[model samples]
Target chain A: MMSMHTKNINTHLVEIKDYFKVAISVDCVIFGFNDDELKVLLIESDLKEFKGKWSLLGDIVRPDEELDEAAYRVLKERTGLDDVYMEQVQTFGAIHRHPAGRVITVAYYSLVNIEHVELKLHNNELHWHSVKDLHEMAFDHKQILDTCHERLKQQVLVQPIGFNLLPRKFSLRELQNLYEAILDMELDRRNFRKKFLSMDLLMDLNEEEEDVPHRPAKLYKFNFDKYDQRKKRYLGIGF
Target chain B: MMSMHTKNINTHLVEIKDYFKVAISVDCVIFGFNDDELKVLLIESDLKEFKGKWSLLGDIVRPDEELDEAAYRVLKERTGLDDVYMEQVQTFGAIHRHPAGRVITVAYYSLVNIEHVELKLHNNELHWHSVKDLHEMAFDHKQILDTCHERLKQQVLVQPIGFNLLPRKFSLRELQNLYEAILDMELDRRNFRKKFLSMDLLMDLNEEEEDVPHRPAKLYKFNFDKYDQRKKRYLGIGF
Candidate 1:
């Protein structure tokens, strides 16, 4: 549904950028789940303004760019990944949070299946740090990460977004672990099993994990079609 | 405390605006509660671009002006009301949500103590419309208002923000009614009483209603001090 209005927006922004010297920016908190832990992607800063400090993936917004495009550009430039599950979480404007002087950062968070996409850090040195194991970050990045983490936790309970952070074929145990990690609470195995199965959003693949130490658990894929059909009837409002 | 950073931001924006033709704007969904129903302030569009259609209380953003200041300015200009308790809920940027091209609107929702704030509309065509009774609005304001309504409901439960929408000293019944109106659900009075009192954020003022046809109810004022202390502990993270 690309409306004619969207074209007008592109042209308008081009004109606005030419006139205004305002430096809009985008910051992304890329989330990846692995082995019952929720991790966020961080980059080592190069700018002398934030030298030697780890920061959320961010950069100045291009003058003639859409907000979402700027966010995606930042992600691609830093992570070498595209078409990942991304959503705008919030915008931070504390006036002086940025040392570059009055730069407003629109924060976007993404849920990427770490197994499918290869992590190519390009020019920036990037690493995945466990949310629990985060140290002091550059600028107001600690606060930005906290906000994105909370949004991710809130979203997990209401939507099937967690699937985006896991492999296409995942075990039931893996799914349970993802929820427990994000919510920061232990779930009763039996109750969790009953609840998720009742939703009928998981399809049995009749396959088992390969190259495991012990007996491998059966694999399953998210039944996106079923979830879509039941979403209207689903009352997944809050925890 | 206004930081030196804010002062720098003010100055930087001034220099940038001299070059850019960008304008700042504020759109307010001034919510009011009366006759046990939730209402929002709206205005008839003056521009030939949106002739005769209803719109939100919005105007252009000023150069070097704080976002909150711009919101309050629009409220005072359109409704002749000042000192309103407004919160920046979210920013909407869908490329074409505005017909005037890519004008990204940062939405601010104000909870006017419908009793304390005067409905002195500066624009003769401005009026308060019940949220449920609203038809098609100019631009994507209907969508923006819906998002604000959700934010208002969520904030009302977790924080004692409802106090800003109601009279300073109000009865428990009135408070409960406000909750029911915003949440759009019938909460048990006993449960509601238990939940709110347990929070320990409201102080009994030991007063009664002035005009009523039924048994007068006792009045209470929100304990802002305790609420502030509780916020330090609670951090507004409620389900």
Candidate 2:
């Protein structure tokens, strides 16, 4: 008869073998801002079982690929863009979430300026959907999208990350509009300007918007250098 | 000759099989406060390669267990504690971090008050070490510990999670001490008390500390029910 310790070791080995069967994948919630509205890049599902539904851009992590690398690969492969700002938000791993097998997906959210990116839709199936009017998505992607969106909303309040969704030189009105769009609320214009200006993270570009029917507001650029210095001083707290 | 689509499908299948060899594990950074010092529970490394070095309690995640459940299981099996406050901080998956093959570990931090409960310590190898004076740890666990510690520090400012590290009823001085230990800095006593009182998340227990040494301060308990109500009203921003 085997000793209890030996039996325990045997059980551990068997458990390890059983766990090796589960696959890991990375899903990207590619967020973009345009027309003063928040949007997410989604792909038409190719799986026969869910042909009509949309899905966030994702791919299985390869044998040699890291989690972040897999997420970047999905972004680059699907959007034909690189060096985008991305962050891993959470991992979703509910049993029976995937139709194929036990696939655990690490979800990441990427923010990009829609005006800057010319998407190379090789398959003509990828499109940006307004976040406000999302349809049913394949798998648990709806929950994943909501989670990433909530993270984005929370992060925008404390961090200067929301500027990544705007053009290089954007007017204060545009900035306020972007914030209002993301946060889904109205802000007192004077208070908003005062708050951002006090942070000293925007550079007066001495430029103004063109080709607008209404008056073009003075444009300002995000001062990343100043932001980085302030970040070093503050460490954890952000304005 | 195989069509491009068929070739791509075959490559995907092969990649999935290759990735299946990688394993996943969960590591728990069980933080406890005692003797006016922040402590973390650690176990002596059983691996022959690192015999004496300490390691955070961890285990390979079973195929059937969720990531959070796996973390809770490690905390329960090692400390014999249940219903503890645990949260997944981050996933550490540096390719060669683990010596025993390709294992990706999800790191979690748990808070438990040392005086309120007894540690089972079934094995003599487990011990609680001061977080400030920890030496080299086994298998990149030192990095994991630092990450979780940083997260805890950031969270303590915005959330009332630090209360979990103290007794149910604690004095203003004890609460301040706990924050100083976790944040690694001395806070102004009057300011700290003012901030916590303004948040309105503590209830005056009308009690006092019972031990000898000094004039016992008034004790208070965390008002979690009030906190939940405030949380719903404020949504993302926690006081």
Best by lDDT: 2
Off-target runs (Cα >4 Å) in candidate 2 are: A1-15, A231-239, B1-15, B231-239
Candidate 1 Cα errors over 4 Å, as ranges:
A1-21, A59-64, A76-83, A99-101, A185-191, A194-200, A204-207, A231-239, B1-24, B59-86, B94-102, B153-164, B168-239
Report lDDT (CA) for all predictions: 0.70, 0.76
Q: Give TM per candidate.
A: 0.73, 0.90
Give candidate 2's total backbone clashes: 0
Q: Please give, for residues B1-239, the per-residue lDDT of candidate 1 as tens digits.
A: 12311222211233333212222345788999888889898877755556687888775454455667778877775556787778877776565566554456678899886666665543426677888888787777888899999888766744567777788888999988888888888778897788778777779888899889999999988888865654243121211
What DockQ does each candidate score versus the true complex, computed on alpha carbons? 0.11, 0.33
Candidate 2 i-RMS: 5.8
Candidate 1 lDDT over A1-239, as tens digits, reads 22321222212232333323334567889999997899888767655666777788765544466778877876675567788889887777665676554566678999887775566543346688899888687788999899999888777865788899999998888888998888787877887777788777789999999998878999999888876766354131111
Checking candidate 2 for backbone clashes, the offending pairs are none
TM-score of 2: 0.90
Model 2's CAPRI class? acceptable
